[model samples]
Target: MILSSPDPAADPHVAAALLRLQRTSYAREAVLVGDERISPLLEDEIGLTAWRGRWLMAWDGVQLVGAIAWWETDDAVEIHRVMVSTSAMRRGIASTLLSRVLASASGRPVAAATGRANQPAVALYAKHGFRAESDEQIPPGIWITRFRHAA
Candidate 1:
């Protein structure tokens, strides 16, 4: 597997593929969380391109398998999204992408949020030294857990 930052504007095809993957990946999370209104599932290619962040993508040869997106603040990096294609789950793709994200943090803190009921995601973050700090309700009923990696 290869990891790289891809410019969506430079390749429309890749942008579309990533959008499709995001939708599919987030759809499963929606089910896990008992909500179909997650924001990632509603994003279009145009909106995705407009997001202000860096995307780290994992590829197996020419196939896109996983990706993580984040934006840096003065003291912390906020992970906006982490996804692996449905067919690519259980393959360490998400972990690899997240490892790259944490390594790029340069000692700054890193934080992310996932559905509170999404055990796989919660476990993944915990395994990487992130501690759950709180839980929040976004769409009124949907619960999300916030996690922060130790600095």
Candidate 2:
């Protein structure tokens, strides 16, 4: 399936879908993050405006199954979010989104981070050629693992 850019202006549905994706996906990470931050992180505005970076959404004939977004820094593209509908997990949605993003970032380094306990995300990054660069305690209680995709 082909990935498409989100049209926040034309589609109101994306706002809700992105909100739900954020809520559910981050719930798993809330153990590493407090409810205070996780709650706001699920807010729709953040996901709706995610297109300010590189956003890619996968559609299965009008139904949005997955989405991702990333920001390009001076030296690397930092993936900010990657989400697939619960029913769409393990079906290559994230992989397809990442592949599309990586293609756009061709010849440059790509990077991503996830909660240290989020093994699936770590595995996904590894599957796409990203190697773990650091695991650090960025906050009082949270451990974040940073990964970089070498060119």
Candidate 3:
């Protein structure tokens, strides 16, 4: 696997490719959480291109297999998304992408949220030393757990 960082605004193809992977990956996440209205499921290429965050993309040969997006806040790295194609699951792509972000965090803590029912995601964060900090229920009773890794 290979990793790369590319600005979506600087490359329309990057935006489109990420959008495709994001949709499928989040679609699987939506199924895992029993919620079809997750934010990533609703994002489009325009939304992706408009995001002012950094991205780390993973490639298997020429295939775009995974991506993680995040931005730095004053005290932490706020991870917005960790996505891996359904066909590429269990290949350590998500872990690799997330580790890359954590490595570059520069002593800032890391924060992320995932559906409370998404066991794989919850376990993934736990394996990376992130602890569940809070559980928030959005409208329609969808619960999400926020995680934090202290600096």
**What is the TM-score of each predicted model, taking all chains together?**
0.96, 0.83, 0.96
User: Which stretches of model 3 miss by more than 4 angstroms?
Assistant: none
Model 1 agreement with the true structure over 1-151: per-residue lDDT tens digits: 9988987767898898899889988988999999998889888889999886999999888888899999997788999999999999999999999998899898999989999999889999999999999999987899999999977
Provide C-alpha RMSD values for all models, in order: 0.9, 2.8, 1.1
lDDT of 3 at 104: 88
Candidate 2 or 1, higher TM-score: 1
Predictions in order: lDDT: 0.91, 0.76, 0.90
Better of 1 and 3 by lDDT: 1
Q: How close is candidate 3 to the true structure, as a TM-score?
A: 0.96
| Candidate 3 Cα lDDT to native | 0.90
Whose TM-score is greatest here?
1
Error of 2 at 47 (Å): 6.7
* Pairs clashing within candidate 3: none
Alpha-carbon error at 24 in model 3, in Å? 0.6
- Model 3: per-residue Cα lDDT over 1-151, one tens digit each: 8899999889988788889999888887788888888889877788888899999999888789999999997677999999998999998988898988998897899999999999999999999999999999864678999999887
